[model samples]
Target: MSNANSDPLIVSHDLESISDVMRIVNREIWVVTAAAGNERGGLVATWVSAASIDDQTPTVLVGLAPNHYTTQLVEQSGSLTLHLLRESQLDVAWNFALGSGHDRDKLATLEYLLGATDAPRLRDCLAWLDCRVFARLVTGERHLYWVDVVAAARVHPGDALREHQLFASATPEQRQQLIANRDADITLQRPAAITWRKCLPEHLYFQPTQPTN
Candidate 1:
């Protein structure tokens, strides 16, 4: 019996569920935090859905479950911060996504600081935003944050953001370098395996060898 999910002939396209959609939407995204006011802790998130390039504030919104811990703090603070992940931040992005910082001192171990509005902005992030929450609109099971761009900081300039970045495809040069390094591996000091030529009929060869008695 074939599983219905893999049936491509099923004319109706069955898209991913909200959770499944989130798996794609929430990727190597970055947001470092330190002390949400008296909140005394930062909520790092990779599950953000950012869009709307034409808005006056150039809005980037994220949906959080109404019951999520960060949701309450964001609503109470009435503001939040967003950061653009840097090429060097592959580790930072993974740490927060894999673990929860709830009772732990997630900030003490990380390097960060308060932004213009006192929200946590990761020090290593390439770009930062101190946003003001204009509204907390409820969208089904999640509370959507509509933020106002109050302050902006760019740690790196001239970087392209026209498309989303992912780790699956490192730059071409990097991939080539990696493949070359792997093929030319020197871990084994012994010489590479010898390449043997194809064997032909002995009569076809004309070489003569002199044997010593």
Candidate 2:
């Protein structure tokens, strides 16, 4: 008899459940900024985490889409600054999230200063960290950078913006643009994910063994 869990239809349903669960998980919003010579770029991101526990040797893991202009700048400069926006800074998030830096200058209207890492550090953020990429892993659709935090500052004392808050605060036009951007990203990343999975060794994938009666 075939196991119910092994049914393809059930497996597909499980995947959908996983996606639904992910959608509800609250994550902090971050603005990752980078500059390479004359070119500067910034993008809204939610994938950043502490990589080291030691205060003396501060490090963070930042994930950026390989196709993003900010990611390209990080690659060229090996440096970036991460900004934690306040709850009232939805406009700042929208500015970076709504468009690509390759199409227009995202930082032209924003107030920022050159950080110690030489990345653009937005002045209006709740907090900011200047980091240098010491190592990186190029996953299929994302570039994971292990960065050393060289400088950090808490600019303003306020509630940090979260993903759910951002969504709730968006105007109708902003919400529509956000959905369009997400759909475009899904289109680009799906094939890349499949290609990456294909390249991985078959043995690396889990295969359930049949139980002996």
Candidate 3:
């Protein structure tokens, strides 16, 4: 009899956790997601992963607690969208993160519109990808959502906006000046020698005379 676990398809992992990988991958773009269901929603998620596949479509993934409202909505809805936030949109990020629709409606959190499959996509996003959920993986109390990216397109040029959010274009002179000032301050603190020093030349100053006891 053939067995599922007998296959050599199981690959072992060398790393302890996917935290590092997730951080790097999330740095690609930050987005606010709002999915509609019995209770439509909005969430600021930086963590995403692939839980499974959906035929030819690439299954995108996002993890959330099973008991969270987001999970319930996603399971019932089976659809979502990724909105690439603009550079100056830190306000939106903070709002969605700290603010919730638990007591009231969170749909009015940002400027969003219905996309493929009724997924709410932000209007200020640089781009968005609408998806249909494929599968879910259970990792402790969290559920990893694997969804197929059914549709994708550029809504606006949010690359520069993202750059402005994370990295600032610092001038060469400014960087050099900053370094020099930092070094000078360090020197000043280094026993007044390594950081900086002040002394009178032997030829310009006379030695102190010893007190006669």
Top candidate when judged by TM-score against the true structure: 2
The superposed Cα distance between candidate 2 and the true structure at residue 78, in angstroms, equals 0.5
Q: Write the per-residue lDDT of candidate 3 for residues 1-213, one digit (tens) a residue.
A: 334443232233433465455445325344535454456676656556544565565777776544445556677788778766666666665445443456555567466678887867777767778878777765433467777888888867646234234324335664465456446544443343321213434554567899999
- The TM-score of candidate 3 is 0.57
| Candidates in descending TM-score order | 2, 3, 1
Model 1: which residue pairs collide?
A: none
Which candidate model has the greater lDDT, 2 or 3? 2
Candidate 1 accuracy as TM-score: 0.56
User: Mind giving the per-residue lDDT tens digits that candidate 1 earns over 14-118?
Assistant: 344543664564354556353455674454455465556775756767765444455676777777777776765655654543334565555566777777777
| Candidate 3 local Cα displacement, residue 102, angstroms | 1.3
Find the number of clashing residue pairs for candidate 2. Answer: 0
**Cα lDDT of all candidates, in order?**
0.57, 0.90, 0.58
* Between candidates 2 and 3, the TM-score winner: 2
**Reference-based TM-score of each model:** 0.56, 0.86, 0.57
